[model samples]
Target: MIAHGSLILVLLFTSPLMEAFSQPTKVVTLVMFKWEIKEEARLLERRMLYLHETLDVR
Candidate 1:
């Protein structure tokens, strides 16, 4: 019973540290997603410009 209680205490103390470690992973994922979106937007813009130029030439 005592061991179980101690284990619970350990978990309680460590949970916040675990959460803190995970927070940065979430931020990194968000930043990476944002960059991916920006890159995709740039690619789309380039494609649109190419299409516009092709249409104008025709």
Candidate 2:
């Protein structure tokens, strides 16, 4: 019973530390994802403008 109680206490303490360590990674991934989305959008816009310019020239 004592060992079981200590194990529970250990888990309770470690879970928050684990969450703290993991939280920044989640934020970093979200930032990276947003940046990638913005880059893709800019590329698509550039491609569309290029297509329009070529069509206008021809």
What tens-digit string does per-residue lDDT give for candidate 2 at 7-46? 9999999999999999999999999999999999999999
| CA error at residue 21 for candidate 1, angstroms | 0.6
Alpha-carbon deviation at 13 in model 2, angstroms: 4.4
Error of 1 at 43 (Å): 0.0
The alpha-carbon lDDT assigned to residue 57 of candidate 1 equals: 61
Total clashing pairs in model 1: 0
In model 2, which regions exceed 4 Å deviation?
1-13
lDDT string for model 1 (1-58, tens) is 5698899999998999899999999999999999999999999999999999889963
What is the TM-score of candidate 2? 0.68
Provide TM-scores for the models: 0.68, 0.68
Candidate 1 has a TM-score of 0.68
